[model samples]
Target: MTTERAYHHGDLRRAILAAALDVIAAEGPTALSLRDLARRAGVSHAAPAHHFKDRAGLLTAIAVEGYGLLAATLQKAESLRDLGLQYVRFAAAHPAHFQVMFRPELLRPDDPELLAARERTRNQLHTAVEGYSDDPAIGVMAAWSMAHGFATLLLSHNLDGLLDGRDPEEAFLSLTNEMFQSAKNPATG
Candidate 1:
């Protein structure tokens, strides 16, 4: 067997999670089944349950992982604009994680790891946005809305013709630059 397959077969938690992510990415979270994940992971039907109590617990784990990844991604940004770009890139790259991370109703709201991971990502965004405005909260909201909204649009194909064959990230940079320029010149804004 390949090394990666061997590792998954040896690590049930990771195996189940990997299978769950695949199912979620292919058919959305509602289609995920612990039993199916266990079968795919080469474990007993109850194996996934031992690690994640139920579908919500499994989803909470996914959310925690997603937020941790997002925190790491955002932490690497040198500027607010870079942070926004990273946020969009992250969502585009991890659509399954992105889908689960925002759906609070589908996860265990009290999961400590999930809460901490979410806070870490949020704090990173807040810190990045604070440099641009006196009210960091508002800046954070605006920046996150723009980036997340843009990502959603791109993922849903809502921005189809608007892209005009331009790469998504390049288009985002161009749009952000225009917005910044407009903000600098009120008459144009």
Candidate 2:
């Protein structure tokens, strides 16, 4: 067997979760199970329980990791608009996590790690609008709406089918920019 299949110790949890993501990405959430993940990870069927109490625990872990990854992606962008594009890209790239990340009810908000990751993403998004206008609260809410709407539309294929000739990201950026700019114009107020 390969060294990767050895599974000596120290990171079995991560390895199992990675294997789980691979399965979920390939098949779907319906096909995912701790025993199946443990098999893919080259560990014993009982091994996963040491990390995840059950299937729900595994799903929670996936959601937690997804939130952290989303936060990191948002933080990497130079601006809120760029972050919105990146958010769509990230969702397309990590469909496994993207599938679970948003259903907040699926995760225990009381779980410290999940909450921290969620808050980190929220704060990062809030920071992205720090220079938008004098009212940080309004600016943040507007940016949030744009990003969330764009990401949701992209994921749901709402824009994917409608944006056949144009780049969806560019279209989203252009449309939101114009609308927000128009809204900000005092002449229109």
Considering summed lDDT, which 10 consecutive residues are worst modelled in model 1? 1-10
lDDT of 2 by residue, 1-189 (tens): 542455674678788888878887777666778887877777788988988888767878998888888877877787777887777777877888987777665556577787788888888877877887799988877777776777777766788667887877788778778886777884643
| lDDT tens per residue, model 1, 56-95 | 9999999999998888788778888888899999999899
- Displacement of the residue 123 alpha carbon in candidate 1, Å: 0.8
RMSD of 1: 2.5
Model 1 off-target regions past 4 Å?
Answer: 1-10
TM-score of each: 0.91, 0.80
RMSD of each: 2.5, 3.0
